[model samples]
Target chain A: MNDLARTIEALLFIAPEPLEVATIQDITGEGPDGIAGALEEVRGRHGPDTGLELAEVAGGWALRTRGDLAAACDALRARPREDRLSPAALETLAVVAYLEPVTRREIGRLRGVDVDSTVSSLLDRGLIEEADRPHAGPTTYRTTTAFLERFGLARRGDLPTLERFELTGPEAGALRARLEHADLIAEAETGDA
Target chain B: MRGTNPAEGRAGDAGNLGGVPARDASAALTQEVEIDLFQGPFDLLLTLLLRDEVDLLELPLADLVEEAVTPATDERWEIDAASQLVLLLAAIADLKGRRMLGEEVEDEPDADALAMREALVGRLVAYAPFQRAALWLADRLRAAERPRYRRVPPGTATPVPVHDDPARLSAAIDRMVVAPPAPSLAHMGVVRRPLPELLVRLRDSLARLREVSFDRIVADCDRLEEALTLLAALELVRRGEAELRQDVPFGDILITGTRA
Candidate 1:
């Protein structure tokens, strides 16, 4: 392969995050047009049908395993259910997740119990962090991406609605899957969903 | 001490006071007096009960009346006296209830005592939302309070021209947007082409024309597929079959007339 193609392949393989045109240029010492042309070539060679496909996500390019291969990847990386949080922890997490930029004082008042230790644990686990609270004496806390990953959420908005608490685990999961499929169908039909 | 007859002293005082009622005179005296006895309702009740030495089960109302009649201080004592009197009345009622019960009469303390504590808890509960609302209000107020002055420093870097007014600006914004004047092609390094057909096409194109427009040669291609194939062919040409122009904007050229 040409040096440009080889450089593009190396970038896709080693990039910690999705690669942008600017980043590719910086790495290959190429201009915007050169990098754009080279990426187009790389993408054309590896289409969606390939084992590894170039995907544009979050405003950048990445070489991702095809969507069909996700189940297999999940099977390989999946851990036992023993690490799941207890009911109390989940409840605390739900409140914090929903009302973030909330404080321990506010949470304690709502739950009718002091949550200092629980908040500390969440912070230690990197599931939540202390966010800025303007003028208030209390320091606000917010959920992190690790929290989303742990909960299998694409983003915070992917969190189950408050109404979902009435449903059983499998029922909720099935509902979530149906919603996701519907979203996919809609995105395919309209190009934006 | 100078009054030989108390009736004559009373008459002289009444005359000096301009026929004001005796009750009014006493009320005026109480108003002029000052006393720091009362703290709050509960504290005042406790103080009055202690002063009267009235048993909790048997409060002496007649003694309380006598105490109320006497003025205590020299100035501004009316407030203290009024609060004390109210407490005295409440204590009397409590004492009567205790007497009627004839035992320790362990009823719950006044709702006011517990009311204070309950109110404190309520305040604590309400504080969170209040603080959040306050923060939101403060943020809005701060945003509204910002000064609109544009005080550029004297020796600072001159402000760059915006595209909004191009007449005052020398350089075109479109030129800035489409960077670097021309695409830098030096980054594309020559390597071996894998496709046999692409190599044959390069030999064919090079033999037909001494030089060709690279973009035009791949213009018929729907996507980047043919362009990439053409790029691979050009790299092979660079390796052996043909030569490339090394100029300001390089284009593909054939050095040898032979078709591979």
Candidate 2:
């Protein structure tokens, strides 16, 4: 690779977070076309067989452990992680993820619960943040790039649809039975006799 | 399996409802059976039930109310959870009753009831996608084998210390917002009269009275102006336009202009 590509690779390697192309341009004094070409070169250099892959995640370039090597890495070192999302947290995050720049009231309205603590927890984890704009309305929140990085998504559009979690055969059967029971109880209690 | 309900055997196993009579089993079903799909705040249970296609109008409200007010378990009820659950159930029950009443009496459906139902169903519908997304996220987290790499690990960096005193911060901002009292120019050095202007003025004064004593020229002048007058007298002497004489120590010098 040429000097530009090598320099870009070095910068991405050393950066604590993903490096944006504009940042690379600022540092290297390279034009957009030149930087794009160098990034492509850097990406190409890290082929599938390589341990680390140059991934474009969270709107920037990052060097990440290859998906297949994750198991081996886990065996090599037990990385300290406290990122497990509880069921409540996942639900709150899902609401924020899909309907972002949303207010606490809007989230509560949809989830049918108060989400104050959940919102604060997400904020502390750096997975979501308050939108920084002046307005007369209440404060709003949106997912951070850290959310995408942790979930291995390149962008919000990469998120899977909710249809994937739609109740399947057995699960659907169980829910149907519960509904039937509720109907029966309603009839018996209302003096249907 | 279709003819025989297995949930019947499992019913007694649910929360302290073992001795519940057959007549009250349905109420037990509503109150005791914990949903296996998702667990969260009691408020979310309504949406999950809605997602499962349980008609809100058909929910066993009277029986559920009995179960809520006097739960079968000896365990202390979470007051917040119980109160919120009762509030939601009451709202749904009210909506159900009004809709039924409208169907019986009114030729046209009640707009208020329709709006309320629409809002409730709309919340359910909107929340359904996120419920599914949450499951997907959980699955993704479980399946992810390798955590992302970091050259410098997170949480290692020292956090920037913050001054968190609200009153002081407010005062600081208030001080900034109101334009500072127009900066005092008293301490600033500003020449009221330029040396050149003073020099010209002194020469003109000498011309007006050719032999004026230095003390008379500076009688009304300040210290700075007095110093400037002395310099101007020297400049005149340098050009041979004036002469200075002091007969006694610490006496004022006399100036004599050369011009007629």
Candidate 3:
């Protein structure tokens, strides 16, 4: 490996969170485009059969253990985590994730319940956050990077596919793009059932 | 499930020689309304219409509105979406009645009831995607959020959002929503115990004595005045006007002047 690739790997190893391309540039005193090349080299070295792999998550690059070793690491550490979210929290989180930039009133309407406690719980857990839009009335919210991290997604746009295999709705042919999410999944999210 | 048997249940209830108790009817109503809450409002409406094999656009507005507003589905999320649907139905029915009658332009109000009906149709059409997306995302999260570690990128050097204290996070959110104070009045009248005064005091006190405890230095200070004096002393130390020493963690911090 070259000097730049080694430096980038070391930097990723030391970083406590995902490092954006811009941040790497500031520290490395290299151009954005140049750092991209180095990142590719470092990522290439840590592939299958390696202990770790480089990932681009939450719109930034990070180095993490390969997926296969997760169980082994947890077993070795014996770290028991009490992190299962309540059903109400999961429902509330789903709303914020998909209909983000949505206000509390909008969420309440969708869920048909007062979501004050659930909202507070999600906020405390670093899942959803106030978008703080300059609106006249109540506050609005959006999901955070931590939310994506918890759900094992690279970014917000990578939400799972809900498309039905068959399309037979009235506007299916004409409104294909608009009605993309309307397909009925055979066995979709557990909550949906 | 209720959609499949609404008629049968109603038929069964009607056949009763003895009228059902008020409590049983209300309990059944609450249970029915609870069913509609989880299913998106648009999806529920579509299901009800589809169960009767009715056309979507040419909906029976009056019948649907009566069902929605009255105790059919037990109205909840009633404040926003339920009410909106009821309003839209009323507006559509009124518009249909007006068209049946003559168009009275002079007496007509400016709300454009026809336009409101069109908007409601558009909204219901738009909601199909949201319902699917919500289910999609929820299933994805449920699958991913197990206790086991999920592969992710290496974190940055300083973790900004990784604070243990939720109060700080909440405070940061609160600050964002609130308007900041004007800079003109900032620190306007803080009774600053001048750094020079603390420096002179430290110089004189240290001159008489080799070193003094932080408490002894601020012994004369009253209430919050000690904080100001400490701030001044720190400023003096920053400028090499004084020195502070500590023998151990959580131990007494000492303040003294330059040996000259």
Candidate 4:
């Protein structure tokens, strides 16, 4: 497009992580409006038809392979398979995402299970970070920008609404029974061992 | 302590039941009956009970408890499962006992018991949805799997020199690992001149000429001697034994013996 847009595009091309508008402004000495316009122009250059698109992730812009081409590119690259988040890890992440600045105690209490290992795993993965609290107490955790980027979410508000997961009286009963049954099966198997 | 069926190898069979994908009504309905049946599957019975089709007082839990506690062949009891069973059994017994006591003669149920149940249900409700949400996020993670470009830091591209000679390399490595020889101070000489001796010398020179240029007193002197002469002159001036004058900046200083 224009000169500023071209410069911003080149910067994005070289950046390892998504580059924020403020950072671009700092580097270019451009005002907010100018930077915003340039970013828009840069984004316009890569449409759905293009192999690479400018993705706005974690409040920053980055050029990445198009969403649909991810599998093909992955195959071509033949890189080691990325470690997928375990179900337990994901559940813990969801807990942190929803009830951020939450303590380990609260997460454990809600899940009705120990979450020490799970919480540490999420921390190691950079999906969650310890929140800074002025008052002294047990540590609290919250989802990080990395978490948003990984999940491809614009913000916490963009998470799917919880209404669909609400359980009716019968449904709740069924779920409880299911949990109990699973527990029973596990106990039986362990005893057999 | 009911015995387990290891021979049946039902562990593999259980995998088919899925892990808490309870949203599938048909699979849940079919698999709900296949697990253990306490008067035709506890889940189905619980559903009917919650829907008010079955009465708490008429649950026939005494027989269920007897069956639950009976020891089967070649089995051991796990405390967790036993404790869970006890809690469930106790809760059911409490509800039945309270209902039988005719505490309200029927209008309202026990608030404390209802609160406890509600709390348990509330926790499950809050947590279960997140499991599904996590799966959704995982799908998004899969979709967003594109390569990102990063700037290769400057000066990192140069390769480190390789030393092929083993003995030289070993010696080099040993040199690196060993503490370096204490820095040599043999080349440096410490010179100290007595201040009083220099003062006497300056006094003699200033007296011999009555008035002498300050630079002339230390003309052939080294740095230490010059520093000592300057200090001695300042001391003599402070004592009112001599007066020194500088005509301009960077000009020679003239020292005159006031004692004369």
Candidate 4, what DockQ? 0.20
Superposed by TM-score, candidate 1 places the C-alpha of residue A170 at a distance from the truth, in angstroms, of 23
Error of 1 at B166 (Å): 42
Error of 4 at B147 (Å): 5.4
Model 4 chain B: ten consecutive residues of lowest lDDT: B16-25
- What is the TM-score (0 to 1) of candidate 3? 0.42
Listed in order, each prediction's TM-score against the native is: 0.27, 0.48, 0.42, 0.51
Top-scoring candidate (TM-score) = 4
Worst 10-residue lDDT window for candidate 3 chain B reads B21-30
- Give the clashing residue pairs of candidate 4, or none: none
Worst 10 residues of 2 chain B by lDDT: B1-10
Q: What is the lDDT of residue B102 in candidate 2?
A: 62
Q: Say which candidate scores most in lDDT.
A: 4
**Tens digit per residue, CA lDDT, model 4, A1-193:** 8899999999888676778888888789999899889988887898888887877788888877776775677675565667888888887887788788999999998778999999988889898999999899999999998788877776655677766655667877766665544433343343335
If you superpose only chain B onto the true chain B, what TM-score does each candidate give? 0.23, 0.31, 0.27, 0.32
Give the per-residue lDDT of model 2 (tens digit) for B97-208. 7556663322223577446555655555557678889888777666553645765655567433253677877888898899667778776656577777877887787789
Model 4 — TM-score against the truth?
A: 0.51
Superposed model 1: Cα runs more than 4 Å off: A1-10, A18-62, A66-82, A109-114, A133-136, A148-193, B1-260
Which residue pairs show collisions in model 1? B32-B75, B32-B76, B33-B75, B33-B76, B33-B77, B34-B75
True-contact fraction per candidate equals 0.00, 0.43, 0.13, 0.47
Could you give candidate 3's per-residue lDDT for residues A26-129 as a string of tens digits? Answer: 77889987898999999889878898888777777878777667678777666557576766787677777777888888988777679899999989999999
By TM-score, the better pick of 1 and 4 is 4
